[model samples]
Target: MTDARATPPPAEQRLHPWSWLFVLLQQLRQFVVPLLVLLFAGRRGDAGDFAEWAPLVGVGVLVMVAVLQYFTYRYRIGDDGISIRSGLLQRTQREIPFARIHNVALHQTLLHRIFGVAEVRLEAAGGQKPEAQMRVLGLAQALALERRVRHRGTAAAAGGGAEAASPAGDTLLALSTAEVVRLGLVSNRGMIVFAAAFGLLWQAFPERAAADWLQGFFREAMGYAGTLHLGWIGMAAAATATVGVFLALLRLLSVALALSQYHGFRLSEQRRRLTVERGLFARLRTSVPPRRIQAWFLQETLLHRWLGRRSLRIDTATGGREDDPRKLRELAPIAPPEACDRLIAHLLTEAAWPPPRWTPVPRRCWWRLFAGGVPWNLLLTTALAWNFGPWGLLALLWLPWSAYAAWRQAGRLGYAMDARLVAVRGGWWSRWWRLAEIDKLQALRLRRSPLDRWLGTASLWLDTAGAGAMSPPLCIRFLPQAQARALYAQLGRMLAARRLRW
Candidate 1:
C-alpha cells in the first residue's frame, strides 16, 4: 500500500455544541404527537396525572441522553475515508472507505442556519442508510470535509492519490424567484399538504365528530342547491365552477410552498458531479455523480405546456431518508423546454440530445387502454342507471370519450434508443420523456399477460437504481411482440458489452 493508504486516521473529533440542541429538537419532534394524544385523550384523573408528569420525566431523560450522546459521538477523517464512534451502553464504531462513499451531502436546518453550522451525510452504495453522518460542524468545516471525500473518491477511481486541486465547473442552471413561483403553480404540493392536514385532523379528532361535520356540510350544500331549482345543465355548470374554484385555491397554496422551499435554487457541475444548493430557511447542498444517476425524467403537465415550460428530475442511487431534506431529486423545477434540453445536453455530453425520430407503439394498444377502464366505467354507469331512469343514459356518453382518450394516449407512446441512451415518451395528462444510459441499466424484463399474448403484444420494463417508492420503472407497454423481442435482445447485448457503473 502507498504511504497515504497506510497512514492512520487522526484523533477523534466531537461535534459542535449546537448538535445537542438539534438532537433534542429531533427527539421532541418524534414524541410531540404521542404526547399530545396523551394530554388530550386522557379521560381519567390518573391518566391526566400520568400525562403531566410523564412529559417532564421523559424530557429530563431525553436531555440527559442527548448530553451523553453529544459527549460520546465522535468521528475521525482519514486519508482513505471517515470513521464514526457513537453509543453509550452499547458502543458502535463504523469505518467507511472513500472508494465506497457514493455521495457527501451538506444540510443546514433552522437551528444549523442560526448557529452557522451544517450537517454532513456520507452515503454508500447498497446501504439503506447513510454510512456516516455528523450532525453539527462549522459551515467551512463541512464544505472542506465534503470536498476532501469527493476528491479522494474521484482520485481513487482514477487509480491515483488525492489531487492537490479540485476542478470547479461553471454553473449549469439556476432558478429565479419567478421561476420558483411558477414551479409552485405547476406543483401538486398544495394537494399534498391539504391531504396531510386532513389526515392529521382525522387522526386527532373523534371519528364521530368528523363524520358528522362532513355529513352536515354536504347536506347544507345539497339543500342550497335544491333551493336553486335549476335544471341538470345548470347543476353540472355549478359543480364545474365549484371544482374550478377549489383547484385555483389549491394552486395558490402550492405556489406559496414552492416560494418557501426553493427560494434560491441553483445547480452547478464540478468535474463529473452535479451539485444542487437550494431551500430558504433550511439550506441543503447535495452532490450527485453522473454514474449514480439512474434515469432522467422530463415532465410537462397540461398547465406547463400551456405556459411553454417543462421540469427535469432525476433518480440517483443514493437512497432517501425521511429526516433528511437533502435527498430531493429535482434538477430543474421549472424551465423552458429548450433550456431543459440544453441543460440535459450539458450534463450528459456523451448522449445525443433532441433524440432522433421516436418509434410509435402499436395502434392496437388503444384497445388495451379502453379495456382496462371498462370495469370502472361500467360500474359508474350501472350506479347511475339504478339511481335515475332514462336520464341515467347520459353517463354512457363517457364510454366513447374515454375510448377516444385512450386512442390519443396510445398515439403518444413512443421509444427511441441510441448507443449511449434509451428514451421513452408517454403519459396522458402529463407528458413525460424518460432517458436512461445504457451502462446504468440494472435489468430488463419483457412481460406478456394473457391479453397481451392474445393481441400478440408485450411490455418491456427497465430497472435502474435510485428510483423512489412512488416512481415507476421505465416501461413501454403494448409493443408488437416481434419488435419487443428485437429491442429486448438489442438492450441485452448493450448491457452485456458495457460495464455497470452504479
Candidate 2:
C-alpha cells in the first residue's frame, strides 16, 4: 500500500574537505615505517633506485584511498540518534542512539588547526573503541553537534523534556602560567621521554654504537677532569656533580615539555559537566558529565607536599584505554592545597572534609607489612656482601629504616566511608587519597593469602569500572576477617540502596 521510496531521505552530511588530507596523513603515518623497511631492507643499486619510487607510488595509492573514503563516508543526524554510512568495497552502516552516547570529545591537531577544523570522537559506555568519529568538521559545527548530543542525552535520561539548558556555571578554576610551570616541575615526564628516546635509539642503531657513544661522552668528560689533577675523592665528587647536573637538565626538559602541552589549561564546570581546555599546538576540549566520573584521586608527591601543592585526577567510565591521551583525566595538574580542597568540596557536596573519623588499620598489621620488605633488604645485603666483602654488612642498616618506614605506612593507612562516599588513604612517601561514590562500586572482592590466613586476616577490594587494570582498586589490607566481613556487608547495603548513575 505504502511505497518506501516515497519517504524523504534523512539529511546527510560530509566531513570537511580538509579531512581528505587528514586521512591521507594518518595513512602515511601508519605505513611509513613498513614502507621504509621494505625499501631499504638489503637493497643495493638498482634495487634501491626502484625503492626510491616506491614511496611516491605508496603516496599515490594512499591519496586515492583517502579521496575514495571521503566520497563514500556520510552521516545523518536525526531527532533520535546518529547514523553513519562508510566504506567503499565492503560498505558498513552504524546507528547510535542518543541514550547510548557516553561522551563527545573534541580534538585539534596541527593540521586541523591550520585548516580551522576539528576532530570529534563519540564514546559510549563499555565500548572498547570510540562508537563513532568524524576526522574533520568546522569548529562551530563540531561544537553545535556536541551541544545537541549533550542536550539529547540529558533529555533522554530525564524521561523527555525541552532541550537541556545551556551550560550555566562560571569558571571553577583556571591555571596561571606559574602554575603550569609548577605542573612541569612536579611531573616526571622528562625522565619518561628520555627513557623512550633512549629505547628507540637503542633499537634502531647497533647496540655497540650506542654503548660506545655514551661511554665516549662520559670518558671525555672524566678525562677533562683528570687534567685538573683531582685526587680519587675529588674525581668521585666530580662524577657525582656531573650526574646531578645531567638529572637537573632532564628535569628542566620535562618542565619545558609540560609547559608546552598545558600552556593555557583551564577547568570550568557548568550544568554538572566539567570542561577542560588545554594544549599549545594540538588543542583539546573535553567535556565530562558528573555521572560518568567513577572516582577521584588527590595525589601529592613528596616534592608536591613540600611545595604545599596537590593534583586532582578523575577516573571516568567512558575512556577507551589507558593509553588514550584524549581522555582528559586530570582536573587540576597543579594547584594550591587550599584550591584543591575547594574544588573537591564543590564537586562532592555530600562528602564532609576532615572526615568525622578515620579507621586506621590494625597496629598488629605493621609487622606483617614490615616483614614483607625483609626479603628485598636481605637480597640487597647479600649483593653488597658479595661485591664489597665486610663493607657490605653496612647494608644491614637498611633493615631498621625499612621497619620504621613500614611502621609509618601502617599508621598512615586508613579508610573512611559514609552513606554517599568511601575514602581510602595510603602511601609510603607520596600520599594518595582516593574517593569514590558508594553507588559507583561495581563489585567487591575478598581474599586471604597464605600468610594472611595464618595471621587470621583478610583483604577487601572495592572494584569500580573506572579503574584500569594497572590501577589497583580500593584495597583495605590486613583487616581482621570478622571486621572485613562486617565492612563488606555494610558497603553492600549502601550500594543496594543507591542507584548507579554511570
Candidate 3:
C-alpha cells in the first residue's frame, strides 16, 4: 500500500491566520442588528434584568456560535491541488486541481487596509464564477501562495520539465493611465446608463414593489403609445436628455473609481495566454489562456464612433454554468479594437482575414422582413394618420428605416477568408465584424431554401468554439457553386495545416 500519510503538503496551500477576520466581520453583521435592538429596547434601567442580563445572554450565545463556526473552517494545499473545508452542521468540501487553474486574483478593501490583509480569488477554467474568492489573507502570504500555485500550474503545463522551477517569462499586459482611461471611456456607456438608472430609480421608488409596479407601467404605456403622442413625444425627448446628463455624471464618477483602483494597471501577455493585474485598494489579478476564450465582440458605440475608438470584449468558456442567468463576467475591455489590431493580428497570425467584404441576400428574401406582423403597424399608423394628419406620417418612418435596414443587411452580409483567419461581417448601418481563427472553428453548415436554390445561392455558417449561440448563416446569395467549394476547401486546408486539436 502507498504511504499516503508520509507525504507532506505543499507550503503554498496553507490558509492565512487572518482568514478568520472575514468570519468575524460577517458575524458582526449577523449579530449586531439584534444586539442593538435588544440592548436599547429590552433595557429598563442601567442595573435592570432586561438591560444587563438579557443583553449579556443574547450576545454571548450569538458570539459563541459565530466563534464555533469560524474555528471549524479550514483550507489545505497539496501537491496536486487546493482544498477548502467549511460549514458547521452540513460540512462541505471543495477541491480544485492545479491544472485547471487559470488566474489567481488578490483583493483588499479599505477595511482590509486597516488590518494589513487582502483577499484571494482563484480563477479556474471550469468554475461558474470567474474566480472563487476568499477574503482576509495576509497580503504577503497571499502573494507568495499565488506565485507558488501559478508556478505549479505552469510546470504542469510544461510536463514537469526542469524549466518549470525557474520563473516563466512575462504573461501579463499592463495598461498606462492614458490607455486605461481611453478603454474605460470606450467600454463604459452601458455602465453609465446602469448607474443613472439605478440612482434615478432608487430616488423615484425606494421600495422594491413600488419600483416594480412603476417599471411595468412605464413599459406598457410606451408600448401602447407606439410613437403617436406629440405632447408625450416632447416629454420623452426631455426625459431622454435628462437621463443622458445624469448618465454622463455617473459615467465620470465610475471612471474615476476605476482609474483610482487600476491606476497603474498592467497586462502581461504570454504565448497563448494573457494575465491582467490591476487595482490599488483591492488588487485584482486574472489570467486567461487562449483555449478558454469562447467568443469576442468589438463594440463601437455612438460616442466611440465619434471619437474613432472601439472596445473589445472577449467571452470565456469557463463561466455560465449556474442557474442564476444574470451574472456572467466579461473580459474587461482591453483597448480600442483598432488600436489593438496588431495584437489581434498576432493572435490570429495563423489565419489571415482578406479585406472587409460583404454580399447582398437576393431580393426574394424581402418577404421574411415582414415576419413581425404587418397588420398592427399598418393599422396603428393608418388610425393615427387619419386622426392626426402629419403626426400619422411619422408612423411610416419605420418603413424607410426597415427598408434601409434590409438594404444594409444585404450589403453588410459577407464573409472573407485567407490561409489563417476567417472574417464574418454582418448587420445593417451598425455593423459587426467577427474574426475567427481557423484552428478555433467548431462546426460549419450550409443551408439553402427553395427560394435560395431558385436564386442560385446558399448561406454558409461557421460556428466557433466560443460563441453563445449559432447565428444566421453568412448569406452568399447568387454565388457560383465553384466559388463556395473553393472557399470551403481553403478553410479546410488552413485548419488541417495548423493540426488543430478540435
Candidate 4:
C-alpha cells in the first residue's frame, strides 16, 4: 500500500537492464545439474572431450536465447491492465485486464536482491501459466504494477481512499524465530527434499535403482560388521542408532531451511486485499483479495498438537504450479489456535469459525471404515509371520491399531453447513478441516461404491476451483442413503441460482 496521490508509472517500458543475465541464470539452473551429471558419467566412460565441451555449448546457446528474449520482449503498463508483446519470428501478444488478474507476485533471489531487481508474475484464472511474467524489473515498478492491478477499474473509484492507509497496513500474522522452528518440527519438508533429489537422480540415471544400492549396502555392511565379532543384536542396535542419527540430521536441515524461507514472514491486510511477504535469502511478496480464495484448509498434525500450533492454507484461483514462488499457498504456516480463529473471522466474515456443532457420521460407518482396513491388516500379518517365523507375528499388533484408528476416524468424519458455507473435518491423530463457501463450489458428486450400495450408504463430494489433482476434495462419506441424497439435493438447489465465485 502507498499514498493515493502518487505519481503514475510510465506506460511503456522495457525490462531491467540485467534481464538477459537473469534469464540466462534461470535457463542454466534447469540444466546445470544434469550437465554436471552427464560430465561425470562421460569422464568415467573416458569421453573427456565430449564431457568438457557439452556444458560449454549448452551455456553458449542459453546465453544467445536469453539475449534474444531481452531484445524482443516489450510491455505496457496501463491504468486498467497490462499489455505484453514478445517473440521475433512468432510474435505473441497478451492483454490482461487488472480486474481479471487475481494474483500478483514478486520474487527476489539473493542475486536479484543484490542487483535491486525482482521477477514479477501476474496470474489470472483459466490458464496453466501466468498471464504475464517479467523476468526482471525494478522492485518499485513491480510494486506499482501490483497496486495498479489491485486498484483497477470500479475498485479504483470505490476504494481509492483506502490506498492512503499505512504502508504496512494491519498486521494479521507474523512468525517469530521460535514459531518458524516449530513449523520445521511440524513439517516433513526434509524428507520431501531428500525424495525430490532422489527422484531427480533416478530421472538422470534410469538404470540406477535405490533397491540395488540398499541391498548391496546391507550385504557389504553386514559382512564387515560380522568380522568385528558383533552378533545380530549388536548389528541391529547399531543400524537403528545410525538411522536415528540420520533422521536427527534431516530435522536440523529442515530447521535451517525453514529459517531461511520464513524468517521475516508477515501477513497483513490492506485495502481489502491480503499481502504476505516472506523468505530471507530469496524473498517473495504476494497480494491477493479474500474473494480469490476458493477453499480453506486447517491442519493439525501430532507435532502441531505437541507444539500448540496449527497451519492454514488456501486454494486460490491462480495457477497451481507449486514450484512457482509466485503462488501464495500457505496463509499461515504456523499459528496458535486463537490466532487461526481470528484470521478466519477476519477474512471470511460469513463463515462459522469454530462451528457451533459437529455432526458425526452414523454409527454403522464405524464398521464400514473398520472393515475396510481389516483385509490389509490380515495380509500384512500373514506375510510377516510367514517370512520371519514366530517373531514376525508382532505384525498382528496392527489389528488392534487399525480397529482403534477406524473408530476414532469414523467418529471424526462429519460435515457442517449453514446457508452460506460448508465444512468437513476428518482424521484422528493428524486432523484437517476443509471449508468453502456454498456458492464457490464448482461441482457436487454423490459417490456410491459397491460396499456403499450393499450397505445402503452414500458419499457426498464437494469440488471447488483451484484444487490440485493430489489434494483431496471435501468429502462427507458414509451417510444413510436418504440423508446423503437429501444433502446433495439441498446443496444442489442452493447452487442452482447462484454464480460460482471462482
Candidate 2 colliding pairs: none
Compose the digit string of candidate 4's lDDT tens values, residues 1-502.
Answer: 9999998774667898899999999898898988787777877777768776887787899999999999999998666777888998999988888888888888999998999888998888757888888999877667766767777744432222334322447899999999999888778889888889978877766455766877899899878888988687887888899999999988987898899899999998877788999998999999888898888899988989999889999888887485665688888999998898899988888777888988888765777767877788778878988898887778778778878888888878888999888999988888999888998899999999998899898999998887643255688888999999999999999999899887
Cα RMSDs, all models: 4.5, 4.2, 8.2, 5.1
- Among these predicted structures, which one has the highest TM-score? 2
TM-score of 4: 0.87
Candidate 1 is scored at a TM of 0.89
Per-residue lDDT of 255-369 in model 1, one digit per residue for the tens?
8889878989988877667888888888888887767888888999998998889999888788656335677578888999999999889877898988968989977678778
TM-score of every model?
Answer: 0.89, 0.91, 0.66, 0.87
Cα lDDT for residue 486, candidate 3:
63
TM-score winner between 2 and 4, please give it: 2
Between candidates 1 and 4, which one is better according to TM-score?
1
lDDT of each: 0.82, 0.82, 0.59, 0.84
Candidate topping lDDT: 4
Off by over 4 Å in 3: 1-8, 11-14, 23-70, 87-95, 126-132, 153-263, 270-272, 280-282, 320-338, 353-393, 445-461, 464-466, 469-502
Predicted structure 2, TM vs. truth: 0.91
Candidate 4: residue 427 Cα off by (Å): 1.0
Worst lDDT run of 10 residues, candidate 2, spans 156-165
For model 4, the local distance difference test gives: 0.84
